[model samples]
Target: MNTTYYMSYKLSLIASLAGLLYGFDSAVVSGAISHLSNYFSLDAAGTGWAVSSVVLGFMIGAFSGQFIAQSLGRKKALLATGALVFVAGIFTAIPYNFTMFIVFRIIGGIGVGLGSATAPVYIGEISAQKIRGKTLGFYQMMIALGILLVYLVNALVASWIPDSQWGTDYAWRYMLGAMAIPGCLFMGLALFLPESPRWLIDKNRDDEAKSVLTRINGAGYDCQTEITAIKKSFQAPAGAQAQSESLFSRKYRRVSLIVLTMALLANLCGINAVLYYGNVLFENMGIASARTAYYQQVIIGIAFFAAATWAVVNIEKYGRRRLLIIGSFICFVAITLLGALIWVGIASLWMLVLMVVYILFFGGTIGPILWIIIPELSPNRIRGKLMSWATFLIWTGSFIVSQTFPMLTDSVWLNHLFNGSFPFFLYGLFCLLWFLLNLFFVTETSNKSLEQISAEMSQA
Candidate 1:
C-alpha cells in the first residue's frame, strides 16, 4: 500500500469520539463530588461510594464489553455506548434520590466502560500501519478533549451559579448533564463510521472487508493479502509446542498478564484519583476557594489536552516503549515531588506546576500507549475478549483508587506521619513500578501491521 489514508483518518477520528464521551463522564464528577456529598449528607465512605458506584457499572460493562462488540460489530457497539451515555447522563443529573443517583451514574459508567473497551480497537483496526499509532493516539487525544470539555463546562457552570445554590443542589446536576453533549456527538459520529475490516474478515465477510480495507488504504492497497493475513492470524503459530486456542492459552498468556497489569496500573498510578477528586485535592493542597480550584482544574485540563495533542503528533515519532519508559519515570518523579509539596503544605502555584508536569508525561505517553498496547498485544483470534479482560482490570483499579482516595486523605492515622502525602507517595510507588515494568518487558510495535504484531506476541 502506498498510504492513502485520508478516509482512514476521517473514520478513525469519528470512531475516537467514544473516547471523548468516556473522558467527559470520567472527569465531570471532579467538579461536583464535594457539592454532591454535601447535598447528600454523605460520610467519607458514603462519598466514596457515591463516586465509585459508577465504577461498578464500568466493571460490568468491561466484563461484557467484548461480547457486545463481537456480537454487534464495532460500529454498532459504539452506537450502543453512545446511547448508554446519553441516557445515563440525563438520569444521572436529575435523580430523585441518592440511590437513584448511584444507579444512573453506574449506567453512565457502563457507557464509559464500553467506550474504553471498543474505541481504541476500532480505530486501530481501521487505520493503516503507517498511521495506526496516530489513529490510536487520536482516541487518547479525544479523551483529553472530553476532559477539557467537562472542565470548561464545570467552570462555566460554577461561575454562573451562586456558591450557595451550587452547593445546595445545582452544580453536580449541571456538570453531569453536560456530558450528554459528547454522548450525543459520539452517537452521531459512530453512525457514519465503517465497521472494522478485521472484524468483517473474522465474520467471513470477505467482500465487505475488502471494501473497507480499500477505502481505508486506498484503491492500490493489497486488500486480499491483508485479508489473508488477518485470517492467518487466527490460527496457531507454526511450530508451537502446543496449540493455542484462547486468550488464556500459552500463546497469549504472557501478553495477557502484561495487558492486565498495565491496565490496572494505568489508573492505579493515581490519575483517576486526581481527576475524580480535583477540587478536593486542590483544597487539601491549600487552595482556599472552591472557585479558584475549579479554575485550576481548567488549567489542568488544558495541560492534559496539550499533552494528548503531543501524543497524537509524536507517538509515531517516538517508539512506544521509549515513551512509556521515559514517561513513567518522569511521572514517578513528578508524583514524588507532588507528595513532598503536599507534605510540606506548599503553595497552590507550586502544587499546580507539579500536577501539570505529572499530567503532561502521563497524558502524553503512558496514557496513550494503554489505549493501543492492550489491543495491540492481543491476536485477532481473541483480541476483543482479551481487551475486555484488560478493561476489567482498568475499571478495577479505577474503582479501588477513586474509592480509597477520600478515606486515605481524610484518615487521621494514615496522614499523621506524612500529612496528606501518604496516598500520593503510595501512588508514586506504583508509577516507579510502572516505569520498571515497561522498561524491562515492553517491546516497540511501531510501523507494524496488526497481524505482524499479533504474530510477534505469539512467538514471545
Candidate 2:
C-alpha cells in the first residue's frame, strides 16, 4: 500500500480501539452483575443500582468530555481517558467490598463515557469528508466486536467456575479484571496516533495543522484550501457562538432539537435495557435453565454484532436520515408485535423470536446510525461540546430505561393498567414518535460534506 494510505489506515485502527473499550465496558457487566448481586446478598433495587452506576458515571464523564476536548485537543484527551480506564479496570477487579466495587465501576465508566465521545469526534475530524462516514463506521464496528468479545469471554469464564463459586465472591472480580488487558492495549495504541488537524487549527497552530493534514491526505490536495474551509467553519460571524450554545440554544434550536430527539430515539427503542437485562427477561418469560438464558443472550450479542457490521459497510451508501426513518418504522412494528405476543399469551418461543428481530432492527439501523448523525450535524467549532452534551443525554436515557424496566414490569398498579405489557407498549410509543419526528424535521446528509451541511443549516 501507498505510504499515506498506510498511515491513514493505522490511525483509523488506533482511533477505533476506543470503541472496543466502549463495547467491553457495556457487555462485561451483563455477565458479572448477577453474580455480584448474589455475593452481596442484594435486593432488586441494589442490583439495578450496581448495573446502572456505570451509566451515571458515563453521564458525568460525557458532560465533562466536551470541555476536556476543547482544552486538551483530541489526542491528549483520548490518551488520558485510556489511562484512566486502565486504572479503573484494575480497581474494578480487585475491590474487596461492595462499596469498593461500585466505586471502581464508576471510575471505569468515566473512561467508557469519555472514550465514546472522543473516539468518533477524533475519527470525524481526522478523516477526509469523502470517506468520513466509512471511517466512523469502523468505530461502531469495533464497539460491536468488543461486545461480542466480552460475551464470549464471560461465557468461558463462567463455564470454568462452578455455579456455587460464580456468586461465592470471585466470579465478578475476574469478569471485570479481564478488561484490564484490553484497556492497556488501547492506551498503548492511542499514543501512536496524531492529534486532529481541526483541533490544531483551533489552537492556532497552522503550520502543525498543515503537517498533520498533509500526512492524512497525501501530496495532491491543497492544504491551504482545506485550512481555509476549516477556519471559516471555526470562526463564524459575531454572536454566532451564542447561537451555537447547545442543542437547545435558540440559534441552534432546530439542529439541537433534532440531535437530542435522535439520541432519545436511539435509547428508547430499548436496546440497552434489553442487553443489560436480557438474561432476566428470558428467565422471567419461563426459560427454565440458567445456562439456556445465557446462551440465548449470547445469540442476542451475535445479532447485534452482525447488524453493526452491516451498518458500518452500508451507512454512507444508505445515508443517516433514511436509515433513521426506515429503522424507526421497523422497530415500531417489531415492538408492537412483541407486546401483542405477550399480551395475547402466545408461546414463549415466539417472544424470543420477536426479541431477536428487535435486536436485529436496532443494531442494524439505530445503533450505528445514531452516532453517525450526532457528529455530522454539529459545526466543527462546537462539535465536541455538542456531542458531549448529546451523549450525556443518551447515557441518561440509558440509566432511566435500565433502572425503570423492572419496576414497570413488576408494578402491580402498572400491570393492572397496561395488563402486563407496559415496557413494550412504552417503547412502542417511543418508536412511533421517533418515526414522526424524522419525517417532519430530519435532513438528508448523504453526499454532502460536513462543511456543506453546516452551510445549509446556517442558511436555514
Candidate 3:
C-alpha cells in the first residue's frame, strides 16, 4: 500500500523549491548591479535596461508556461525550467560583456517566469484541501527564504573582492551566477517528483493519475472521489472544451480582471523597487556606503523571510482576505512613513526601520497570500493557462516598476521637486488603492478545496 504520511507535504515542498530558484535568480542581481553597471559603463537608463531586460524574458516564459504545463505535464515543465536556470546561471557567471550577460539573465528570468507560474498550480493540485493554504503558502516562504539566502550570499561574495578589485575580478559574475546551485537543486528534486495527478487525469492517464494520488492521499483514500471532482470541474456548456474557457469570456471576466489588477498592483507597491535597487535607493536616501547598504539588505532579507514564514504558519487560521487587509493598512502606514522620512530628510536609521516594517507587513500578508489565492481561484480545466496569464501580468508589473524605478529616482527634475522620495509616495498611494480593491472584490478562500473555490467563483 502506498504511504500517505507526509507525502503531500514532501511533494509540495519540492515544487516550492522552484519559488526559491525564482527568488534567487530575481534578487541576485541586486548584489552585483553596481559593479556590473560600472564594468559595463551603463548609465541609469542603461542600468535599468540591464536590470529589467530579464523581466521581458519572464513575460515570455509566463506567456508560454501554460502550454508547456498542459501539454508536457507539470513535472516535465519544471524539469525544463530547472535546466534553463542552470544553463543561464553558468553562462551569466562566465566572464562576459554586458550583451552576453543580459542574454543569459533573460534566459534565467524565463526559468523564473515558468517556475512562478507552475509551482503554485502544481502544489495546489497535489496538496490536500486540509492543508492547501499552508501548502500554497510554502512556495512564498521558499521565495522569501531564497531571497534571504541570496542576500547573505551576496554579502559574503561582495566581501571577497574589494570595490577596487571588483571590476577586474569575477565577484559580480559570482553573485549573479551563484543562482545555479539552487536551480540545479530544483531540477534534481523535480526529477523525483510525480506529476500533478489532476493534470494527468486531464490528459486521460487516469490509472497513472490514480497511482500518484494514492501515494499522496494514502491507499485507503478514495482517489476516485477526487478524480470525479476534477472531472466535474471541467463540466461546461455543450461542446465547450475546457481550454476555450478564455479569461476574457463572460464567464471569467470578473475573476480575470481581479487576477490582472491584483497582479499589477501587487508589484506596483514598490517591493521589487526596493529589492532590485536597494543599494541605489539607500545611497539616494543618504546611506553611508555600499557596505552599509549590504548590511541593511541582509537585515531586510531576514525580516522578510521571517514574516513570510509567519504568514505560512497562520494563513490557514486567519483567513486570506483578512490578512491582506491588515497587511494593506500596515503596509500603507509603513510605506507612507518611509516616503515621508526620505522626503523630510530623517535619519537613515529611522528610514531603515520603517522600510523593515513595510517589508514585514507586506511579506506576511500580501506576498504569500496571492500565491495561494490565484491558483485556488482558477477553474481546474484552464488552471494552467490562467496561471500563465497571471504570471505574465505579474512579470509585466515587475518589469514596468523595475525598469522605471531607476529612471524615476535618477530624474533630476523629479528628484529636485520631491527630494528623491517621489517613487515611495507613488508606491504608497498604490498600496492604499490595493487595499480598496481587495475590500470590494476579493473573496476569502481559506480552508477550502480547489473545487469549492472554482464553484464559488463561478457562482460569484
Candidate 4:
C-alpha cells in the first residue's frame, strides 16, 4: 500500500515482462509442433528436434548471458534480447523450410535464454530484502501469464482458420509470430528502466547507485545502510580478490554446486516436457482429440497461472526449501499415478485431474523457487556469472528432456517395461529424488538479505 512499494512493484513488473516473452515464446511452440510435423512430414526425431531446438539456443544464450550482462549492463542485455526475439518471431512465421524454421526458433530461444538469465538477476538486485522472494516470484508469475496468453492465442488462431488448413498453413505462423508484439514492448520499456543499483555500486558509481536505491527503498528507508551492506558484500578477505575469482573457484565451489544442481533438477523434473507436449500427451491418454487439445492446453495454462500466483503470494510465508520438498512429493505421487493409469489403460477423467495436479505442484514449487533461490544464493560480485552458468545448466537439462521425451515414450524396450508410459514414471522417480535432495541439502533463504546469504555461503 505504500507509495514506494508501488514504485518498486512497477519497476519489477516491467522487468518481469522478459519472463512473459520467454514463456510465450517457449509455449507457443507447443501448439505449433503437431502442425509442424504434418507440414514437414516429420518423424519422431524431427518433431523432437523442432520442439527442442529453442532449448539448444537457450543453452548458448545462457552460456553467453553473463558476458553480455556484465559488459552491456542487464538493461541493455535485455533490450538486445528483446530485439532478437522480435526478429526471430518475424522470421519464424515465414520460414521457407524446416531448417530455416529451426534457425529462427533457435534465435528466439537465444532471446529467451538471455532474458531468463538477466531479468531475475536484475529484479533481485533492485528489490528490498523483505519482499525479494515475492518480487522474484513475480517473474515466474509473468512466465505463467505468458504461457496462458499464448494458449489463448493458439486456440483463437486455430479456431479462426479452417481445420483443413491447420496442418499446412497460416494458423501456426500467426501463433509463432504473435510473439513479436510482446517482444517490442519489452525492448521499448527496457530502455526507460534504470540499471541495477548493485551493478552500479560494483562499477563504483556510488552516487548514482544511491540515488536509484533511495528511490526504490523510499524516503523512510536507510539507503546508506543498504548501500554499506552491499559494499561490504563485495569486499574480499585477507588473501582473496573477489573480482578476480571465477564462480567455480574454491571460495564459491559449494554455492556454485548447489545452484548448478538445483538448475538441472528443476528442468529434469520434466516441466518442459509437459509444457511442450501437453497436447500430444493428452491425446495419447485419450483425454481429448487433437483439435480439442488446444482448448485443453488453455485449461493447463490456467492451472499453471493460478498455481504460480499462489507461489508468489506464499513463497515468503512458507520458505523455499519446505515448499520445494512438499511440491516434489506431490508431483511424484501425481506423475506416478498418471503413469499407472496409462499402463492400466484407464482413460478416466482422473488422468486429466492428475496432470493438472502435477502442474500445480510444479508451478508453485520448483518453477518459481528455482529462479528465486539461485539469485539469493549467489554473491553480488559473481551473481551474473553464476546465474548465467546455472541457467545454462538448466537449459541443458531442458534440451535433454524436450529432445528425448518422445523417444523415451516411444522406446521399444521402455515400452515393454512400462507400457509406453516409461518417461512419466522416470520423471516421477526424479521428483522423489529431488524431494530428498531438497530436504537434505537445500537451505532456507526466505526474508534473508542478499548480504546475509552471501556471508552464509562464504562461511559454508
TM-score per prediction, in order, is: 0.96, 0.95, 0.97, 0.97
Model 3 residue 4 CA deviation (Å) reads 5.5
Off by more than 4 A, model 2:
1-6, 239-250, 416-420
- Order of quality (lDDT): 4, 3, 1, 2
Whole-model Cα lDDT of every candidate shown, in order: 0.86, 0.79, 0.86, 0.89
User: Can you give the lDDT of residue 137 in candidate 1?
Assistant: 90
What range of 10 consecutive residues in model 3 has the weakest lDDT sum?
A: 162-171
Backbone clash pairs in model 2 (N, Cα, C under 3 Å; residues 3+ apart or in different chains), count: 1
Give one digit per residue, the lDDT tens place, for model 1 in 336-364. 99899888877668778888999999999
lDDT tens per residue, model 3, 1-460 = 1244389889988999988987888888888888888777899889998889889888988888998888898998899889999999899888457788889989988988888888999999999887889889999999999999999998888677755665435677888778889988888989999988988888889999999998888879898988898888877867755534877676777777887788888988889988888877777678748777887888889998999999988988899999998898788888888888878878668888888899999999999998999998887766888899988988998898889999998899997898878888899998998899899989998777888888777653
Q: How much is 193 displaced in model 3, in angstroms? A: 0.8
State in Å the error of residue 451, model 4: 0.5
Model 2 CA lDDT for position 44: 70
Which residue pairs in model 2 clash with each other?
Answer: 247-256
Candidate 4 residue runs with Cα over 4 Å from true position: 242-244
Off by over 4 Å in 3: 1-5, 239-244
Output the worst ten-in-a-row residue range by lDDT, candidate 2. 243-252
RMSD of 1: 2.0
Instruction: At residue 207, give the lDDT of candidate 4.
Output: 91
Q: Rank candidates by TM-score, best first.
A: 4, 3, 1, 2
What is the C-alpha lDDT profile of model 4 across 1-460, one tens digit per residue? 5565776788889999999998899899899888888888898899899989999989888889999998888889889888999999899999999999999999999998999999999999988778889889999999999999999998988788666665567777999999999999999999988989988888888999988887887777788888888999988876778533677777788888888888887888888878999889888888888789999999999999999999999998999999999999999999899889988889988988998999998999989998899999998767899999999999998999999998888788888888877888888888888898899988999878899998888663
